[model samples]
Target: MSAALSVINLAVLARRLHDTSLLPALTPVSVGTLVYPAPTSTVEINPNWEVLYWNTSVYGVVDNSVILECGTTLPDLYIWSFTQPGTEAIKAVVYNLGRGPKIQKIAKTLGQLTIVLKSADVSIEKLLLAANGLFTCQAFYNIDEDPKVHYYYVHLTVRVPVSKPNLLMTGTPVEGSKLWMHCSVDNGTGPIKYIWKHETQNENITNLNESNSVIYVDDVKRNYTGWYHCVVSNAVNTESSDKVWLDIKFGPDDPQIDVSPKTTSEWGYTILETQNVSLLCQAMSNPPSQYLWFYNNFQINIGPKLTITRILRNGTGNYSCSAQNSYLNTSSSRTISLTVYFGPDNPQIDVSSNTVMDRIYTAVEPENGYVALETQGVSLLCQAQSNPPGHFIWFFNNSQVHTGSQLTIPKIHRNQSGNYTCSAQNTYLNSSSSRTIHLTVYCECHLQQY
Candidate 1:
């Protein structure tokens, strides 16, 4: 008995136990041996497994590899199986008999397969499109009689990258016709989403399609003509197709007429008489446009530009350009008024009503002519006919006196009795006309016997 007790004490010391009892109580030890004093180590963590490690979702691409984890539990046996996208049957792919990985023919058919026994992870290599579905990983730690079996489910999706897209169309779009545009892809996985983009307009036109893969226009307008492209996208990747051109055939638009040597006026354009001018017509049309020029409602010239060597008073009226598209049988016209500023024609200088005109001389005395005037509040008047009206300048004896149409003398003196000149100027035309009149301011003492 003593020897048996000594053997029991030695057995307890070997186990590093401090209990004095010969047969002490021992807590049940877990199946696998702990690597360290604590528990937190496994295989390398893939960022893709952040959701799949605890749950049952996994995403993978075709001809690629995936890792299916079975938590942190260490198992003695592992069996990998799979269920296709639309099946309820579970088929075994590979298994590990606590020895090493042995891949089955089913696994080889799907792709290359590996079972990592150390970390309880199933690695699928060279994934195939047919391998997309739910996968089940069954792990066992103890004997089969009362086995602690763990079941881990992973939902796997195999995807194919999106290929370049294509658009099916024939010729240029015509106005007032049925317009149909179709966007197609060679192959892709999952629910493919299509987005249509107008490069020139910088807008998304996918909303224009009810199915989101086609574009429709009942009556295409000019604004719809531009470069267009389609983007095909799925859960795996996205790709954009090459751009295509959509030309909408229309008619000549309203013509825009512009003139050279043009001056801006409140009403229209202003030009000096005898000045060279050119009128240009601009219009947008499919087959170009024929231009016709009109002056005062009279057709005068044809072509895109009309040249006038010397603009005259007769040409100073409403000028118009008519653009006609022969192909579409449509025409547009625009008009602009041109003002030709000619001159301060002929200016005449005259004395005020209070001034007396000799019987021989007229009221408006000619230059170097005589006018009878004294201290009778004599004033000079300058009259002229001009296109923008005329500004008059007064000069006495060729010296500048005032700058108005009327020059008044409050008191007439002999010094003021020199040749008074009035200059009428057309500032716009830069032309001037002048008339000089001689005034004789004599005292009544010298004026005898009328």
Candidate 2:
């Protein structure tokens, strides 16, 4: 028989023997025994073999202990004869439900019989069934004998389990700022699914389905600054890591200036003598900054404000200051002008006081009514007045006669002088004048009193 027909026949026999109930009218009764039917096979194997069977057609009837004969007629078989009377051996062949045929045997002799199969072309189920069943033997003659075949089958199943997920963070969090996290597993075969959770009061969070293990938080708040982790899972298992913290940083604001000697006037001024002037520059900032002073366009080498001691005329000019920090720089102030005053110097005069005389005559002849006589010096006095007076000069006959303002004659002689002129001058002004006089000298009258 073929392997396919044997398997089909076995299956039919099992269903009829195990599944069919004989009495359909039987009902359950109180205080009576119950009957249960046996289970039918979903699959089966057939052709049970017995231990004492042999090919009667191929070998002459020896006793039950006879070994099968080998001849030119059975080219594929080997037979060995034994002396023991009751010993017997049988070999059975079966076909695999999946591949080829297999042989199995049982021996009842003290001696051994080795049966070698042509090839290992049989399925595992067929070999197992042949080994499990009782042995039987049959004989076939001629090349047309139906090929002996048997059949067998098998079934398989599998199982899997659920797991917990885990998450990881890639970078640190910025203070009061956003954070980013990544999800992964310790040991799993995966394309894992990722999820994120915030353990806040609201428990508001989201799930992302991407192959990448990172998640981002935008526009983070103070409350959002908390323990954060991730969940990574697959069809097989899931896991999570420990929570992490985050931190963020910020900065300072702009600055301003305030002038001491509180003056609301856009420009500040002070009446300083030959003394030092101090200016205070103040501003608002996170950290105090350095102060720089500027005069006109040039930067001042001094402190926040420029100080000039014995402030002279040159020390006065435009002034300004600047304040600077790491973040920002700013300038504030106005230009100021200074003035100085003084007194006048000593004064002087150019004038003189001296004696000088001239003579004048009415006529040159003595008969002219007593001969009136007039006399004058050659030069006259010239005087000038001042706090510290200057020098003066006198002129006679339209010529300078004295280095000073005055000219003098000892006696009024007849030939003493003619015209006298003088001039006075100083830093303030100048003046000039001229005078004429005549003089007479008479001898003692010698008439002898006649």
Candidate 3:
């Protein structure tokens, strides 16, 4: 064997010779003498040759093709081997030798040369993540004692596009339960990033910045109920998962009551007798809240609101509301007192004897009007029926006598008795009513003779 080498690319010359028949179907091969020292590194290969290596990197996604080159002119013998990721096992996949395993199942010899290397091409067609590994192409030229070999290897990294992620939940989310959301894909190449999304009825969509496939939320609440999904992305592609509804069962909080026809007085909320009023109750709950209304501790209505078409003075009392959550079997309540203001009716005089504590008599009015004896203590009182009792004024014989509901005289004389008038005034209605009593005074001397 001679150690002579040719500078022309023998692979191109071989193609031209094979096409024109300038020579026999035999190919012209390059024979070269060794120059570089043997690589101190040893790779896994059966029947190993001097591994002077030149490595190039290639990246390809799933369903795409990557071309690998020998990087040398035509040699007498070339061997291609495959090494799986994270393994020491080497398999002769495609080679000129007839004794090794075949990569013809997923590979083909490409006719186009590489742009930079100007070398022969072999393509791994339709790459898969399963095919991630190292590919070595060794070219050999036999020259007497020192055999020359060139190793052209490619580090092939395969990436698969992320599939539509499938979102899953740990269980039915309930109040105080820990919630776990998982984004899973049947086929995806990692470093895949996952993002969790929350869709709520009252707010905008929220992105839970969770980078893992699974994320957990401690202590779920009723407000945490919403639609959830996941967005998964890789170097290959980005995809989103189908939506999953997260419903949390919680409680009916304390009820609140709102009254219509807003009016207030010194005695709290007030309304006129003929006014219409409404009481609306509400609470925050899951599965909605059931409402019950009560008046003065007696259940009077159901539902969220109680309406009175024409309320009277009798409609004034304590109004209570209870909100209940059927799922949780919990309830809450609140109460309010409603007051309806009415009138001050016709005033009358009621007489009580303060003259004797042991012997007391009350009379609204006598058939003969009022009579009093001279030198006897007498009290004249006025009364009226009204929501808030009324202010009073007293007049005697067309003259102002007093300014209160009671006019008491310790001693009376012959002329001390006359027409006594009491007037009751309602400040709210701006109305007044009056009643006058006729009184006759007698001499104390006649009573002493009796």
Candidate 4:
């Protein structure tokens, strides 16, 4: 048993010495009963040697498998080796036997290196930061060939996830103002892509492929205000930064006034006396607005709205609304006119008499008599007191005659002497008052002038 074990150990030692790191010359070896020409000059090399190059950079993460490329395309015998950074020792890992369809490794094809040269690639598994190094793939022809050896190299770097990033802002955050935001991280692998995230108007998260860490907004609006942050990622892992609040401060726009229970007419607003009135002021501001109400240029109320119960005639005037934002120190104002309708009060009727002393005047009365000379002009006027001007209607003997505040007769005749009534009406209030006057025309005829 001891003699057989010694023979097995000697055979393994011979195999190790044959596949050493140094390039070996073509030689002969005997196996059992057959003699084999070891590695001969019969191996041919293709001249397309310039096609292979070194892969200078490759990134990988810990505990992950990384494929390191050996960019050789020639089908010659190959040997795979590795050299750690800051080291001069070259460790042989795998080699292809010159014999047909034979691949051999220094150890079994399992742990550190699995040479898959069918694709000219070496896969390193269960990697560590210490596994980062330079890998070499060497192609060799037979000993008699010119330039018996060529080598291709690749660098492998094990990466770690990026640390927590930091965000920055430039310029003021206000409406219509330009703003810029930046994101940065201290540690991460290169070729890193940055992603920006923000809370939108509806409070939903959105992602942006902003290319760089900097984000630019040309014209900021109110909707741009929200929570903002950044994420940095590579092939390995991704990490997010702390969130930042971006609040935009804006202006108090022009104020608007709305009055309830107010009707609009051809003249203006018509409001009834002893009615409920509500004035609501509206304006857009960043911090909200404080409302101030003005009547006839006098400040009367402070709030967003004003309510007056049992409104009277004194409530009629030019009303103004102003909104102010205390933080922005800005204000906006709007003005409007309110007309309160009340009349028609007592109506007055005045009639002309030939003699001024006997002129008949009546106020809200039934009737009065006026004596006027025939063939002469006479004028009658109607008057009333009201918030809005009252319309006057004249009737003769209770029949509608004319629609005017005044009535004039071009020629006073006997037939025109009758009861004339002047009625005053406030169209908005639907109230009316009237007065009547009767005119009597007489003829003072003498000798004819022909």
Candidate 5:
């Protein structure tokens, strides 16, 4: 029994005995022990058998109501006492004896008070931090003057909800620099946890969990630009702060060019002199990238777009686009190739004949050339220059005889010698040019040297 509890029992005994003079001298004694100094009158007092001490702790939020329960049944006489470090007080009483429930000692700061008789519990409304302490409910059961003490004790702790956090950026963020952010709240209880969220420009979401309120981006990157928010949570409630945009200054990523009138040939993009061509460049950057175009590795234009009214052969080369971020002094480039194509111009036919007479007898001849004898071997080639080398087809006496650039005759006969025509075709341009040559077989018997 604490000194406070001893005082509680002394008051209960004085109330039950109507006559204050018959009460024995109050002596501080441990709970469950009775000290009797011989009652002056014949009136006798029954001793309390037990002193119940409750060790339960109650949790509550500020401005909320909590109950201090005293078992299930109401006692004949009960008194509630509180013990705090500095502010020791007790309230929450209703229907004491004959009087209607009269609340006592509770100020407006302590909130409202109500008593629940059916459960023998005291409800403390509008609770504050000042109410944080030990509450003892001393109840006397039965109508007897029995001094039995039923003590219901409660230890209360008050909490407050977390407030919205304020997110602060430590400094201006730049690419490759350290980025620091701090989250703080104006009002909140201790043990508050914070969480940070990052939502990118592309709608990608990332969550970082931390016990700390401060966060750091060791290496700030372009992709780190996004909306950031901090979530604050305590035991009572959770709140989120307003979002802050983190825009990081970065470089112009590698440039990519899109070519219009896109046709693929041995030359990257093929077009004719009469056709129009367009080239477009694009890059990912923070402040938008400026572009410069290069034709055959030479500066030719500027901006993201370039158009050719009429493409010529001289424009056929590696076209490059340089993307630059002037603020960061960084640049990136990409190159594409283009070609201006024309027709497979007038093709020429050359004939080479071989004779056994000298074993190495050779001469380059044109149309109407002779093969010497019936056993002479001859070969004819059709040559042309075009954007994409032309496909070739050959004809002997106006009829298709072979395909490709060359035609060969292993043994030449007098009847077999005739007009051999070669046609070069540019499949891409749908154009053709042809040239013809004739070979005649001459025998030694018909010598003109006689």
Candidate 6:
């Protein structure tokens, strides 16, 4: 009867097998059919799939004898005697899609029925449900009594991008001097924010966190001098930078004084004679001013023209000028009233000749120590008178002899004797006198009697 309907269709396919939602289902069951002394059937497989094929059909009609083997021709055929041994389970789940739950989980171990998914959640159905990958597997053996099933599918793709915030300027801005602004974000994910702007203060705003980037201004005025920017956010992305302008340059101002012959003369009129005079000082700023000159009130080291080489009469009083820069300072002209002039009042020295016993008996005249005679004899004359002309010097015993106004000893020998002294020099008096003349030498001796 067709072999009892193939044994009731193999017992209803093994009672409709069961894989629940452990996915992947493949079942094939048929036992003891082709009747022929049958009593050698075995099939077992639960090591997930490995048992290619096994077939048999034997009948006794005229030529019927079939058998296929693998399992080493099954001695007593025992591959666990027919399935049931597969239970090494592991499960993990984490999902925070609406950005609220905050998920985290980790577990490891792979071998035998291997399933490895370290570091998951790169989206894509959470990495195929944590690598159970829509499951599929099968294996049946009985020395290959025909049983096999294996199928797998896992697909995933994910990418993330949203992080950009940086604006810096902690230094380099001095217009009125004092500025700082910095904002950064390399990581601290999402919901971040900071804003500091100035395009000339548009309602001036400043709100920063994440341990602040920096924003300090002690004093920087001049309307805080223009352009300075910063705006960084996170709710996805936002950044702006490129605006910093501060120009500061300081100067030299506050200086004044100018005078040149602004006259008021008295000690001898006009060009303030008796010598040297120069007075002038001009200072005007914007970074160009520095001049100081004073006379009568001291401080006037000469140069910048306030010179008075010899403008005597006590350099004729009051003269002032001062101008400075680096912030306010002024003093100019008027204080001057200088006048000096005079002549011919420095001279007085006269020596009528020498006598202190002729300077104790003159002699020592070697070219100019007085006593020099030979042009009509008694030489010793020293006169220095001034208002202008004065200089005459002659000293015999005590050195120095002969220098102007008069000192002439001509034709007076006997070594011209010594000690005569006379000196007079003027620019302002110096006079001396001494005289001694005992010099007599007349040669005319002739005695030849032997």
For each candidate in turn, the TM-score is: 0.54, 0.22, 0.74, 0.63, 0.62, 0.22
1 against 5, candidate with superior TM-score? 5
Question: Cα lDDT for residue 138, model 6?
Answer: 18
Which candidate, 1 or 5, has the higher lDDT? 5
Which candidate gets the maximum lDDT versus the true structure?
A: 5
Alpha carbon lDDT of each predicted model: 0.70, 0.36, 0.69, 0.69, 0.71, 0.38
Window of ten residues with lowest summed lDDT in model 1 = 31-40
Per residue, candidate 4 scores C-alpha lDDT tens digits across 197-232 of 989767899887577978988999987789999988
What are the RMSDs of all candidates, in order? 15.2, 30.5, 9.5, 11.6, 9.5, 24.3
What is the total number of backbone clashes in candidate 1? 0
lDDT tens digits, residue span 182-248, model 3: 8889887788888888899776799877778998888887777888889989888999999888889
Stretches off by above 4 angstroms in model 4 are 1-131, 135-155, 266-268, 351-379, 408-420, 427-431, 437-450
RMSD of 2: 30.5
Candidate 3 local Cα displacement, residue 289, angstroms: 1.3
Cα lDDT tens digits, model 6, 1-450, are 122322332333333343221122233232322111111223353455343333322111111111112223212111101111132121222221123222223311111111212211122222211222111111122323433421111111111122354566655343346666666656533455566666654545343332445777656544554566666655435666566654432222232333344443333223434566666655434334556677787876533556556566566566666555444343344355454533323322222223211222335423323222232345344443232244555666677766665665544555655455554444432333333333332222311221
For model 2, residues 1-24, the per-residue Cα lDDT tens digits are: 222333353344335444222111
**Candidates ranked, most accurate by lDDT first:** 5, 1, 4, 3, 6, 2
Model 6 whole-model lDDT (C-alpha atoms): 0.38
TM-score of 2: 0.22
Reference-based TM-score, model 5? 0.62
Q: What pairs collide in candidate 1?
A: none
Question: What TM-score would candidate 3 get against the native?
Answer: 0.74
Which residue runs of candidate 5 sit more than 4 Å off their true CA positions?
Answer: 1-48, 85-120, 142-144, 171-175, 193-195, 198-212, 221-225, 263-268, 296-300, 326-329, 343-450
Q: Candidate 1: lDDT of 246?
A: 81
